[model samples]
Target chain A: MMNRKILLHSRPQGLPTEDTFKFEEAPIQEPEEGQVLVKSIYLSVDPYMRGRMNDSKSYVPPYPLGEVITGGVVGEVIESRSDQFSKGDKVLGMLGWQLYNVADADKLQQVDENIAPLSAYLSVIGMTGLTAYFGLMDIGRPKAGETVVVSGAAGAVGSIVGQIAKIQGAHVVGIAGSDEKTDWLTKELGFDAAINYKTTPNMKEALEKACPNGVDIYFDNVGGDISDAVMTQLNDYARIPLCGAISSYNQEEGSDVGPRILTKLIKTRSMIKGFVLGDYADRLPEGAKMLGQWLAEGKLRYEETILEGFDRVPEAFLELFQGTNIGKMLVKVESTE
Target chain B: MMNRKILLHSRPQGLPTEDTFKFEEAPIQEPEEGQVLVKSIYLSVDPYMRGRMNDSKSYVPPYPLGEVITGGVVGEVIESRSDQFSKGDKVLGMLGWQLYNVADADKLQQVDENIAPLSAYLSVIGMTGLTAYFGLMDIGRPKAGETVVVSGAAGAVGSIVGQIAKIQGAHVVGIAGSDEKTDWLTKELGFDAAINYKTTPNMKEALEKACPNGVDIYFDNVGGDISDAVMTQLNDYARIPLCGAISSYNQEEGSDVGPRILTKLIKTRSMIKGFVLGDYADRLPEGAKMLGQWLAEGKLRYEETILEGFDRVPEAFLELFQGTNIGKMLVKVESTE
Candidate 1:
């Protein structure tokens, strides 16, 4: 059988283009001792991957030139040569943007399809949801009756962050890019208020009006002007868990400039902490247990926007910057079926 | 007895001028049944007092137009109607910028001159020292061999912060406005390196050379371009204690702007906390004990710039922005002697 894979052809200076990626085909490799050959089912496309494309220092090393682009993958094991797994076992591992992969058996975790859909392993119950859980519960620490603000409110991590804030009995406000996304947040996700930043002429005014009592906790996913507006409304001793900055990811390195917040912090006696999901690796089991409990109790809800076919993988990733997805963006590889 | 007091005549738009203060004469206030009359001796002119001059909400109420400017005062309790204080008691209280103040007995803490000089109550063993103690120990938490950078390094809080960091075995680097101040930091205060920001054409480069290793803790006293430069050199999991921002105190409200720090914080996975000494009021005795012990062991030393007469109180305050003092600045009320 033949396997197809996408590789990084070039590193873009700003926003990536079509020429930045390349596709190639090869014969499927055999599983050696203590290894498994897996057929890919679903691939996760995250905004954080954009940071890895640049040749700079980050939480993870930059993606090198002409290698299989790597990310989260849900697959079925077709051949196993180790004691860890067998044929027809559904699994989840950090694999690649490829049709088939030969990986170490110990690295793959067996996931039961009977529990939930295979794509859910890449989203709400996976890294994205855990990112929201730890950042809000650990750093943001939203108290009851306190106002909590979420930026990029319609995206994967942010949507879950708002719902969790609601569960904690906090006054939840969201900021999104489109009117429909804002409506989905307020109407479907139970957000108290949501602002369409694209349509709103004055973000600071809208934020002040939405959070009348001032913001107590801000879970920031998209930092820049939206964060600047949210910062002006922080109450005394406010906590900000800075998760991501999709707004500044594609720009030139030193071009991300704005009005400084040091004086404001000094005046309000507040704090801001920037973190990544890996920082809480030791507490993953605790987070997963809570997320699963919340899901079973109907205290949490999630959405998925899946595109068909492995050929459309890059398009799914590009759509993240376009703000076209309502929740987690995934690519379903139809070739495995 | 007669009293001469300074009032906030007009709130300046930027730098405070002579027209902003009014000198007035009035009869000394008499102590009530539960009060004591305090004759002011050494009065503190601090950078933080500048915030009280503006008509804005802060940790304390603003200095109202045409009223005595209130601040820290070391005094002698001359007359007492309450049982708490006696005729010859040396005490410390928050009193106005005037010759005499009538206050409740419970509001004053009797200080012993045998421990240190009376001016020490306003400097190393008092509020200024406590500000450094909690900010560095509680927030910065510098580990052994880590690099600690402190701005405004020759001022009251900054000098104490640098010495405390040195005691913790951290590689301490200081940034000051003048060569003389920088010399004092490295030569006398045990700082590993010192950078003269006013003379250095490239501050970022000077900081890079001074701190060969990236900074692990930053005790920020003066915020603006210097802080903007310091933020670039932070290591992973770095902690910043935002103590004061004297650089931006005189600018218009919105004019205190610079390159935003959210993206950098995210990349470094760091944290910044803004705090005041009042937040740790319950732990003041603990901090004071530690500071006094350090002074006795010769681990900590301090200096004071005393303007000879109470008439120069405003000049002593204005010299703070001019960087004219090597340590704590005070107005000595010669008439009280």
Candidate 2:
């Protein structure tokens, strides 16, 4: 059978263009011992992928040219040569950008679709969910009645961060790129206030109006001027979880306006801590179980911006940088059945 | 008896000048019911005092114009009306920039001059020592064989920080403002290496040469480009204790250079924590007891830049911002005898 795959033709210099990737087809390889052939059902298009496309040292190595673009994928095991995975079982693994992947069965986690939608496993109940869970609870440590401000609040990881802060009885404020996403955050996600960063002329003033008590916990996803504005309103002993800097991820070179709040941090006696979801991989099951329980109780709500068809994965990934995705950005490769 | 005091005559716009202060004399007041009249012997000139001179909101209230500049002082009780203190007893308290102070006896800590020198009570065996000890141990948490880099490495606080890191079995690097201070750090303080920032063309390269493995714990006393350079060399899970930002303390307005290395912090998955000695005031006794033992055993060495007379306190403070003082800056008001 022909297996279609998206390959990294060249590393991106700045923002990635469609030309950076190439679509190619290959013969489906038979699953060797302790391996399963996964039919890609849903693929995650995330902001962190931008870092992997750069030829620089990072937490993980950069993607090599001519290799399949690496990413998280939720799929079904169509064929298996190992006792670990069974045929027709739903699984989530790092299967990259491909229609069919011969993956090690040990790397895949069996998923129960009855608990939630299959796509949710690649988002809210997956890496994005765990990223928000550990980054907020372990680092931010939002206290009851404390004010929490989240950047990229309408995006996948941020949406969950706001909801989790709200569930913990915190006054949550969200900063998003559009008015529509802002309304959804406040009206549906139970956020106290939402600042549409695109329309907001003065973010510092907006934050002041929304959080009068000053931000006690800041879950930073977009680290540029938005972070600087939020930092000025931070209360004494504030905890900041530096999850991602989506604002600067696409830039080829460093900006003149870097994170300008270090002196303010010293003055307020606040803390800024950086973290990644993979760092806490050992505790993923613990985070997933808690998130699963919260989802069943309807205490946590998530939104997904799905782009239909495997051919449109690059377009979906591009839309993430443009802030076009309302929630977790995902691309559908094939039907679950 | 005539009591002399150094008062803040005018608010400093930038760097404090001689005209910023006024020396005045008045008749010494009698001790009230719960008070004791103490004669000042050694006065501490700290960087935090510069913050108190500005008319702005801070952790501590700004010192009013024409008021005695606030600071910690080691004194001897000349007259006592309270049971808490007795005549001829040496004590340490916030007696400000004055030759005599009528303060509540309960506010003073009795000191044994025989344990160490009386002046050491205001420095190495006192606040500066405790600031370095707790700020490094509690916040930095350096592990054995890890690398530690300290800014203002020859200053009162930073000097102690490098030594303490060495005691904890970490390879310590000191960044100072002069060649003399750098030599003192490496030869006298037992630092592995010392960088004279004034002579060094590139701080990042100097840091790279000193710490080949990258910095694990950074004790920041002077914040600005030095801090920015040190931050770039921080390893994963590095801890930074933001003790003081002496570089920016004298500036009336904020600098244009925002913390340019904050993005590096996220990439490195490090932590920057701001701390004040006052926050850990309750635990002072614990740190003091330990530091006292270290001093008595000759495990820790200290240097003092003693400026003669109470009138030299303002000049001594100005020297701190100019990076002229080596180790702790003190104003010797009178002989203990």
Candidate 3:
């Protein structure tokens, strides 16, 4: 048997291109003790991956040159050498871009597909869900009647955040790259208002108008000018959960400078916090339980943009930068059965 | 009786000048049914006052043109009508830059001078003390063995913050403008190390050397280049209590841009919160009790640069901008006797 994988060809200078990744094929190996041979079903391609492509110090280390890029992957265990995993068991874990992964059984989390779709495990019921949960509840702490403006609102993490804020009785406003995304957020996700950042030349004014009352909680995923606009509309004692700065993740160091926010912070007596999902690893089960309950109760809705075939992985990853994905961007390598 | 007062003659453009203030004399009035005639003994000239001189929206409204600038003042109730105040009682309240104030007795906090010195009510045991206590304990939340770096370490609030962090058993490092201030922080206040920001050519390197372990909490008072240097040395999950931005108070709008801190916050999963002392008004007694205990136990010491005479109020206020004051800068308007 053969295993096809994607490798980090080179570190990106600015935005990543096709040349940044390299394709490889290797002989499938047998699972050693406490290991499983898993066939990849779905692969998550997120904006945070852009940071891993750069050769700089960050919360997580950069992807090494000529190494298989590893990320959140949902797979089916075809063969297991450990009692923790079994044949035909669906699982989720950090695995390489390869179609077939020989991973430690202990690292693989068994997934029950009957609860929700397999892709949801890599998204709404997975890391993205937990990211929104902790970043909002733990940091943002949205109170009833508070206005929450979510940047990158149509994305996986953001869409969940908006829904969570709404569930918490907050007035939700979303900012997205396209009118389609804006429509989906406002019409489908029940967002109070949605600002299409691409069409809105005056984002600050648009946000100010959307949030008649100043923004109390700003869920920042797309930083840069979007964050600058949001900063201007923050209310007194506003909380900003800085989930990601995807806008500047692809840019070179020191090239992107946000507006002087300290003055605004002082004026409003606000708080800005930056965090990652992995930081709340210990409490992820709690977040997942809550998200699952919300999903089962139909209080939380999710969307996904799926690309078929393993070769489309790089294309799917690149689409994130172009703002093509409405929710979670996932690439299907093989059928679950 | 004739009352000598200082008025905001003109708004400052870049830095405040002597011409910005106008001295006046007014006839002292008798106490009304609910008011008391308090003779100002000590007047606090804080850096936050610089923001009040500008015509802009902030936590507090700007100082009105040609009006007596009001601030935290320690006074003695010479005459009273309301039972809340008594003759010869030491009090603390928001009073104008004048010799005598006929203020409502209900608004005054009758401070016991026996607990500490009368001026200590204006410095370590009053608003300044409360600012450090809440900002550090509530926002910064410095744990034992953590490294706490305080900017404007020689100022009214910063000096107390360093001492409080010490009481919490943290490795305290201070950043101040002058070598004298740095020496006082380390030699007098028990700071682990001190960085003379004004003289240090490479502040980031100097800070790195001072804080061998990365900074866990940054009590920011002077928030310009000094803050930028501190941000570079911040450890993961660092907390920054944004107390004041004295460095930018004098500069014109858009002239003061600190380095992009959002990226740093993201990299370290850090947080920055701006707050005022009034936010914790109800909890003042709790902090006061703790501070008083520390003062009594000799764990906390306070210093003040007293500019004698009411006419020196403007000069004393200007001294803050020049970084001349070692600790709390005050104008002794009248002798305690």
**Candidate maximizing DockQ:** 1
Looking at model 2 chain B, report the run of 10 residues with the lowest lDDT sum. Answer: B252-261
Show model 3 residue runs off by greater than 4 Å. A335-337, B335-337
Residue A235 in candidate 3, Cα distance off native in Å: 0.8
lDDT of each: 0.92, 0.89, 0.91
Clashing residue pairs for model 3: none
lDDT by residue (A47-150, candidate 1, tens digit) is 98998999888778899999999999999999999899999999999898999999999889999888778988888888899999999999999899999999
Over 4 Å off, model 1: A335-337, B335-337
- Model 3: fraction of the reference interface contacts it also forms: 0.66
User: Tens digit of lDDT per residue, candidate 1, span B51-140?
Assistant: 989988777789999999999999999999999999889999998999999989998999999999999999999889999999999999
Say what the interface RMSD of candidate 1 is: 1.1
A222-272: candidate 3 lDDT, tens digit per residue? 888888889988889999999988888777766676567787798789999
Candidate 2: where is the Cα deviation over 4 Å?
Answer: A335-337, B335-337
Q: Candidate 1, what DockQ?
A: 0.78
lDDT, candidate 1, residue A148?
Answer: 98
Candidate 1 chain B: worst-modelled 10 consecutive residues by lDDT: B252-261
Candidates 2 and 3: which is better by DockQ?
3
